[model samples]
Target: MDEARWIQQARAGDVESFGRLVRAYQTAVYNLAYRMLGDRMEAEDAAQETFLRAFRHLDRYDPERPFRTWLLSIAAHHCIDRLRRQRPDLPLDPGYLGDEDPDPEAALIRKETRETVQRLLRHLPPTDRAVVVLYYWYGESLRGIAEALGLTVSAVKSRLHRARWRLAQGLEATDEV
Candidate 1:
């Protein structure tokens, strides 16, 4: 079935349809959450919460909009809310406590890059960071972001552009220093 058809079925209280929808988008949603939250456990929790919230609000979803966008918005809001409530002093490795990567060098590089971006993201306000993550990291479009955040499309575009420029400048400054 098409996404809209599944959405419609899910909205009408079809459990199987909803499960199918969840199966289809679970990885993307989890990956997005994991990147934003920087903790595997929190990401999993957030991803679960996103689908739950989306399922609860399924009736309110406008079928004209993409289903994934709607679901992602829920996950983003949940992750941001959690981040706001947490203490910054605590360590950020939220996944398996002692998990080792198979490729140590490549893993180290990825971990370092993630740490750098997370550090930079911490400097941004939640809304700006969400825009940056959704647009640049997750490849969400202006319209998708706007729908997700309940912002105007123009506002989403402007915020995304500004966030990208700021991140670029930050990287350049780091390179210089």
Candidate 2:
């Protein structure tokens, strides 16, 4: 069935329809949370919270927009909120996620690169990091990002450019070190 039909069914108290939506989106949501939080356990918690929020607010969703986009918007908000609450003392370690690849050499290189990027990303403001992750890691288009982030397309594009520049500058500094 189409998403609209599934959403309509879910809205009408069809648990199975909602479950189908959840099953379809669980991975993407988890991946986004994981990338944002950098801890599997925290990511799991965020993912759960995302779904809970989505379910609770399902009635409020505008059917004109894509359901997945709506769902991700919720997830992104939850992750950013979580980050804010911890912003005082906690530092974002970009390499906190690390590499899962099995090849030793490849894994080592990947870890190093990820760590470097993470370190750079840590220095960036969370807003910039959020844009970079959503744009680059999630492959969200500017329009999708605008919808997910509740920003204008121009704003998202500007932020992405600044974030990329900040990341590049940080990496350059790391190389000097």
Candidate 3:
């Protein structure tokens, strides 16, 4: 069944339908959590918590909005909260730890790239990090990101611009080092 059908069934307390929804979105939710939290165990915990919250609030979900967007918003918000609470130290490698490449060199390059990006991301505030993750990693539009993060579109735009500039300056500095 499609997302809508599954959602309707889930709202009706169909365990199987909700299981389908979980199956469909687990990887995406996990990836978002991982990106924001930068720790494998923490991300997994956050993702599980996200799904639990989503299920509890499923009745409040608006069908007019995309289901994945709603779910992602939940994951993003949860990860942001976690980030604020822990405020972990930087240089967290934010790669999809589950991924594997056939070539060792390619894998090494990807690992380095992820480490660089995560280092850049660590400098941003939680809200700015959320904006970057939602926009760049998830392909969310400005409006969509704003809605997901409860910010105005202009605010989202400003954050994105500032965050990108910070990343650029940071990368430039690293290049000189």
Which candidate should be chosen as best, given lDDT against the real structure? 3
lDDT of 2 by residue, 1-177 (tens): 577787888888888888888999999898778777766687899999998888878899998887877887898888888878764455554454444788999988988876666577666665666777778777889989988888899999999888878878888888899
Report the Cα lDDT for residue 157, model 1: 81
lDDT of 3 by residue, 28-49 (tens): 9998888787878888999999
TM-score of each: 0.79, 0.83, 0.93
Residue 57 error, candidate 3, Å: 0.4
Where does candidate 1 stray beyond 4 Å?
Answer: 94-103, 165-177
Predicted model with the maximum TM-score: 3
Model 2 / residue 58 / CA error / Å: 0.9
* Clashes found in each candidate (C-alpha, N, C closer than 3 A): 0, 1, 0
- Residue 91, candidate 3: Cα error in Å is 6.3
After TM-score superposition, what is the CA distance of residue 2 in candidate 1 from its true location, in Å?
3.6
Candidate 3 ranges with C-alpha deviation above 4 Å? 90-95
lDDT scores in order: 0.80, 0.80, 0.89
Better of 1 and 3 by TM-score: 3
